[model samples]
Target: MPDETVTAAEPGVGTPNVERDIEDEEEKEAEQARDVEKGGVPVATGAEEVSGGKEERDPNMISWDGPDDPLNPQNWSFGQKWAAMGIVSVFTFMSPLSSSMVAPALPQISRDLGITGDPTLSSMTLSIFVLGFAVGPLVLGPLSEIYGRVRVLQLANLFFLIFNIAGGFAQSKGQMMAFRFLSGFGGGGPIALGGGVLGDMFLPEQRGLAQALYSLGPLSGPAIGPMISGFIVQSIDWRWIFWITSIVDGVIQVLGLILLRETYAPKLLGDKVRRLKRETGNDKLYSVYDKHDRSMRAILSRGMVRPFIFLGTEPLCQIIGTYMALMYGVLYLLLTTFAELWVTEYGESSGIAGLNYLAIGAGYTAGSQIGAWLIDATYRRMKVKNNDIGLPEFRIPIILVSAPISVLGLILYGWTAQYKVFWFVPDLGVFIYGMGTLSAWLAIQTYLVDTYTLYAASAIAATALYRSLLGFAFPLFANQMYAAMGQGWANTMLAFITLIIGVPAPLVFLKYGHKLRERSSMARKSRIIR
Candidate 1:
C-alpha cells in the first residue's frame, strides 16, 4: 500500500509533464513486469490490453501499479481523508457512549426487571457490554483485513443498532444482558477498525492530528455518555437511554453509508482484479492477498488468530498492551467512582454529581487539542533532527510527560476527596488526570499504528483485548477496593501502579523498538509487502 503522505504528480490533459510522467511510470511498470517474469510469475502489462491480443496473469501474484496509483487510500485528498476520519471517529464514539451511558439507568433497569437480589447482575448488565468490546475485536479486526473496513464497520454498527434497540424493550434480565452483549459486540467494530482506517488514510508524519481527533471518540465518550444519560434517566425514563443511542446510531449509520468509502488496499485491489477478470475475460487475475490454494476459511482463521499471536509473541505488543489496559482500567475506575464520591462524600444530588464528569470531558477536549499540536510538533522536530526520518519513538515523549502528571493528579484527587476538601480541588485533580490519560493514550495509539502499520487493526485489537477486559473488571472491583482500603490508600495503590507501568515503557520502547520490530514476524511481513 502506498503511504498516504506520498503525493504523485497531478497531470492535466495535454500537458508535457503529464505525458512524461505517464511514460516514465509505464517504463517503470514494464521493469516491474520484467522482474515478475524473471521471478517465474506470469505478468499482464495492463489490465485492458497486453502483447499479442491477450495476456495471462499469475493467479498467485498481484500488486499496485508502481506507487502512485490514485486508488490507494493514502493518495486521497486531505478533505476526503478527514471526512473519513470524522465518520470513523463518530462510529467509535457511539460504541463507548453506549457502553457507559447505561450506568445511570442500571438501578431503574434492575427494579423494572426484578434484578434485585444480586448487584453483580446489575453491574454485569453494564460491564458485560465492555466484555463484548474485548471479544468483538478478536474476530472483527481480522474480518476487516479480509473484507474492507467500511463494510465491516457499517454492518457491525447496524448489528449494534438492532440489538441496542432490542435492549430498550427487553422484558427480563436475561434478555437485557443478551441484548447488551450483542449490541456491544456490534459496537466494537469501530473501536477495532478505526485505527486501521486512519492508518490507511494518513502518513506517519500527518497522523498525529488525525489520531488525536480519532482518539477523542473512545476516550471522551464514556464521560460524555453518562452526562447525557443522567439527565435522560432522571427526566424521561431509563429505557430512553437505549432508544436515544439507537436513534443517534441510526443517524451515524446513514451518514456512514453516504460518506465512507473502501480504504483497504488489498481489498480494493482484489475487487479490481475481479472486475478486470470480468471485463477482460481473464480468470487468472488475482490480488497479492490471494493464494492459489487459499480458501475463505483459511483467510478468516488467520485474521481471527493474528491478534492473539501478536499479543502472545510480540514484546512491544505485550508491554504497550499492558500499559494501555492499565490506563483504561483506571479511567473506568474513575468513571465508576467519581459520582459516588460526589454524592456520598460531599452529599450532592445525583444530577449535580453527574455534572462533575464534565471535568474529565473538558480535560479530554483540552488534552486532545493540545496533544495534537504537541505530537505533530515533536514528531516533525525529531524527524528533522534525525535527517527527516521519523521513528515511532517520537511519540513517546508525551507519555513521559504524562506519567508524572497522571500520578500527581491521582494523588491530589485521592487525598483531596479523602479530606473532603474544596469541591473544585478534587475536580481540578480529575481534570488533570483526564488530560494526562488522554495525552498518554493518544501517544500510545499513534505509536502502535506507526509500528504495526499494515497490521494496525490486529495490533490494536490485541491491545484492546486486555484494555477492555480491565475496563470491565476494574469498575466491578472499584467500590470494594475503595471500601476495603479507603479512598486515599486505594487511589495511592493505583497511582503507584500507573507510575510503575508508565515510566519504564516509553524508555524501553525508545531504546529498543527498532530491534524489537526487526525480530517481529508481523513487522517483517509488513516490510516485505510494502
Candidate 2:
C-alpha cells in the first residue's frame, strides 16, 4: 500500500476553494483540527471540507486537502476515473471468460484426456474454476481492504495469466482441474473487489453506471466466451481456447500496470503519512486510518474474517446473498447445459451451438445497458424527491422488474426446448433469462455497495461467496434435475424457485433495508472501513 495516488505528494494539484494564507504554524494547526472535527476521510464532500472559519482540527492527522482535491478518486478527472474503471473492467472480463471458455471444448477435452464414464467429470471441467472463485474471495476481499485495490488486482491477475497458460498445456484431467481451479482463484479477485473500487470512486448518485458496467464484465464474459471458443474448438484444437484468452488477458494486465492507480482511501492516506513524515522530519504525523494496530498480522487476521462476519451476522448479507446465489446458480446451470440443448435437440454442430450462445450474449449486453441507464437515473430522481438524500433502496426498483423477467425467461426456454419447438424459441428464452439475470446482478451489487459504502468489499464478498458455490454445485445437480423432469419441468422448477426467492427479497429490501442497516453490527458509521 505505497503512495500509488497520482497526486498524493503534491496535494495542491487541484484548485482549493480557500485562498487565505496561514501566517504561522499555530494557525495551520488550528485549521487542521477543525477539518478533522468536520470528519474528513478523503472523497471530500462539501460537508467534510473546511466551512468558513476553521474552529478546530488535528495537526498530526492527514486527510484530503479540500473538497476539490484531485487525489480523491471521486474528484479525479473523468478520463482518469473511467480509465481506471475500464482497465478493471477488462480484467473483470478476462477472468470469467476463462471460467466458461472451455464449455464447448468440454467434449473434445474429455476425448483427448480419456475422461470416460461420468458426465459429472465434464461438468467439473468448468465448475471447478468457479470453486476457485468461492475460495479466493474469502482471502482477496479482505486483503484489498489492507493493501489497496491496484496492487492486489495486478498481482492476482498475473497469477491468473500464468496458471491459465498452464491450463492450455494440461495433458490429463487432474492437471486440467488443478490448473483451472488455480486460475479461477486468481481471477476471482476482480469479482470480489470491483464493487469496492466503485464505492471508492463514485458517490451514490454516480454509482449506477459504474456498477452496471462493472457488473456487466463478469456476467457478459461467461456468456460471450463459449460463443468464440465454439469455433476455435470446431476449427482448431481445443487447447487454443486457453492460450487465446491468456493472450488477451496478458495485454489487459500490461495496461493495468501502466494505467491503474490506487483507489482505496486508507492506503492512499497511509502512503501520504509516510511521505509527510519524511518531508517534515516529524515522526508523529499519521493517517487517521493508520491509528489502528495495523501490523501485518492484525490486518491479515481482520481481513480474513471480515467477510465471514458480514455473511454470518448481517441480515442484509443473508437476504441479498441467498437470492443472488440462486440466480447465479441458474446462470451457470444454463451455461453448462446450454450447448447440449442445441446439439441434441436442434441438430446443430459444435460451432453452431456456440453461435446459439450469442442469444445470451445479446440479452445480457442489452440488459446491462438498460439497467445502467435506469439505475442512476432512478437514484437521482429518488434522491431529489427525498430532498437530496439517497438510500440503497433506490436500487431495488430494477430488481423488482428484472427478477420476474428472469423467471419468465427460464420457463420459456425450458418449455420450448422440452417441446422441441423452433430453435429460435429456446434461444429467445435463453436471451430473456440472460438479460433478466444481468439486470438483477447490476441492481443487487449496487444495493450492497450503497448500503455498506465503507465495507463494500466485505458486503460484496458475502454475496459472492453464495454466488460462486451455487454456480459450482448447481451444475453438479443439473444433469440429474433435467433427466428426471425433462427440460420443461426442470426449468419451470428453477423459474418458480427464482420467483419465490428473487421477487420477495427485493421487496424486503425496499421496505426494511434501512432498519436492518441501523440494527446490523457490521454497519459502518464512517464513510470508509475502519
Candidate 3:
C-alpha cells in the first residue's frame, strides 16, 4: 500500500534500445488492457527495471521501467519454483507438526507435571498453537506484501522455533500453554503465505500439482507428527518431542537460508530500482504505486488491516472467510475429541490412539491430490462451455459437493463414535470427512486466489485470522458439546451450521460473484480471474 518510487537514474544517458524498450512496455500495457477488456488473461510480466535514460511513453500505458528482470519470482525457472515451494512447505509443516505431535504426549506431560484435568486440557495444548495461527497471519501476511515472503517466513520460523523449544523447558502447565501459543504465533507464517507464493510462481491452470504438494505440508504434518510422537513418547521422555523437533527445525532453517528468495514483486522490483539508481546516479526512478502520497506508517497500518477491511467490504471475502473459519475450527475440535474417544471409549493406549490420525492424514492427501487435478480440469471444461470467458466463478462447482460430504462425514463420525460403533466405522467416517475437508479447503483457497490475485496475501490473511481463532475456540468447548447432546446430535448440529454456510456460498458466488467483484477496487486492479 505504500508508494515505492525507484529513484531516477542519471539524466541524458540512454541505452541502445531505450526508445524501443519504452515502445515495448507501452505495447505490453496496451495488450494487457485489451486482454482485460476482452476478459482474456494478461501475460505475466516479471519484475521490470527501467534503463538509465530519459524515456517518453504513451499516456495510456502502465509503464514498467525494465523487462526480463530475473529478480521476479515469476521469472524464476521451474526448479526455482519447486525450491521455494519446498522451503515454504518445510516451514509450514514444522509449526503444525509441533502443535499436534504433542497430542499423543500430552497425557505423559500431564502425568509428569502432576496435573490432572479434563480431556480438553490435552486438546488445549494442540489447539492453542492454532490460536497463534489466527493472530500471526494478520501481521505476517501483510508484512510479506510490504517486505517480501522469504524474509518474513524464515524470521517467523525462528521465532516459532525458539518458543517451541522453550516449551520443553516449561516448569508448569501454565508455562507450557503460554509457550505453545507463542510458538504457534511464530509458526503461522508458512500457512498464511504458502498459497500466495504458489500463486506468484504458477498460473491458475498450472497451479494444481503445486498446490497439492503445498497442501500436504499442513494436512499431513498433523497426522505424521502423532505417529512419530507416539513412538518417541513410548521410547523416551515427552520433552524430546520439543527437543527433537527443534533440532529438525534448525536444519530447515539452514535450508531456508540457502534456498528461499524474496517472492513479493513490489519489494523485489523496488530493490532492483534502488540498485539501478545507485549505479546510474539518477533520481527519477518510480513505480506505479508511487503515484499515491501515503506515509510509510499509514501504509503499514492500511496494509496490516487490509484483510479485515476486505473481509468487511467484500461479500466473497465474508462468505469464504466464514466458511473456512468454521472448517478450521471443526478440524481442531475433531483432533481434540478423538484422543479421548479412542483411549477412554475404546481402551486404546496412547500410541494406538495416536495412530487413528492416519485416517485424517490419508483422507487429506487423497482429497488434495484428487481435488488438485479436478480443479484445473473443471476450470478448463467450464472455460470451453462459457465460450472461454473464464470467470472466477468457474472454480465454484466443487464446493457444492465437497461441503455436503464434509457435513455428512462429521455427522456419521459423531454418531458412530458416541454409540461405541466399530472403531473401523468411525475411521471410515473420518476418512470420508477428510476427503470432504480436502475438497472444501482446496475450493476456497483456489477461489480466494482467483478472486484476489494481487491481494491474495490479505484475502488469505482474513481467512486465516477467523479460521485460526475458531480453531482455538472450538476445542475449548468440544467437551461441553459432546457431553450435552452426545456425539451424534452435536455433530448433527455442526453439520447443519456448516450446510447453512457452505451450501449457499458456492452457488451465490457462481451467480453473483462478478457483480460482487465489480464493486471491489482491489479486485478490479488485480489479474485473478478474467
- Identify the superior model by lDDT, candidate 2 or candidate 3: 2
Q: Sort by lDDT, best first.
A: 1, 2, 3
| lDDT, candidate 3, 1-530, per-residue tens | 22122222244566334433332333333334333223222222333324575333323222233334465566689899999899888888888888788777777887876557776676687788988988888778767756778888988999999998899898888998899999999998898889889887877767767877787776678767887787788788789999999999999999999998887655665676577678877657643333332345544565565676677777788888888888878877777677778888999877787788888888888888888888889988988998876667777888898889988888889889989898988888888888887777887788788777767777888888888888888988888888898889988898899999999988898888988887765566454234
TM-score per candidate, in order? Answer: 0.87, 0.89, 0.85
The residue-by-residue lDDT of candidate 1 on 453-517, one tens digit each, is 75677789999999999988888877678888877888889999999989998889888888997
Off by over 4 Å in 1: 1-62, 291-294, 528-530
Q: Per-residue lDDT tens digits of candidate 2, residues 1-530?
A: 01111111234656332211211211322223233334463222112346585433457768877667777788888898899999888888889988998988888899999887778888899999999998888788768767899999998899999999999999999999999999999999998878878878887778878877788788888898898998999899999999999888888888999999999877898898899999999998877565445566655565566677677778888888888898888888888988887888789888999998899889988898898888888988998898787778888898899999989988999999999998899889989998888888888888887777656776787778888999999888777789899999999988998899889988888888878876764443322221
Could you tell me the TM-score of candidate 2?
0.89
RMSD of each: 10.0, 9.3, 8.7
Scored by Cα lDDT, where does model 2 land? Answer: 0.80
Q: After superposition, how far is residue 176 of candidate 2 from its true place, in Å?
A: 1.0
Cα lDDT, all candidates: 0.80, 0.80, 0.76
* Candidate 1 CA-lDDT value: 0.80
**Pairs clashing within candidate 2:** 32-57, 32-58, 33-56, 33-57, 33-58, 34-56, 34-57
- Name every residue pair that clashes in candidate 1: 4-74
Q: Cα deviation in Å at residue 25, candidate 2?
A: 32
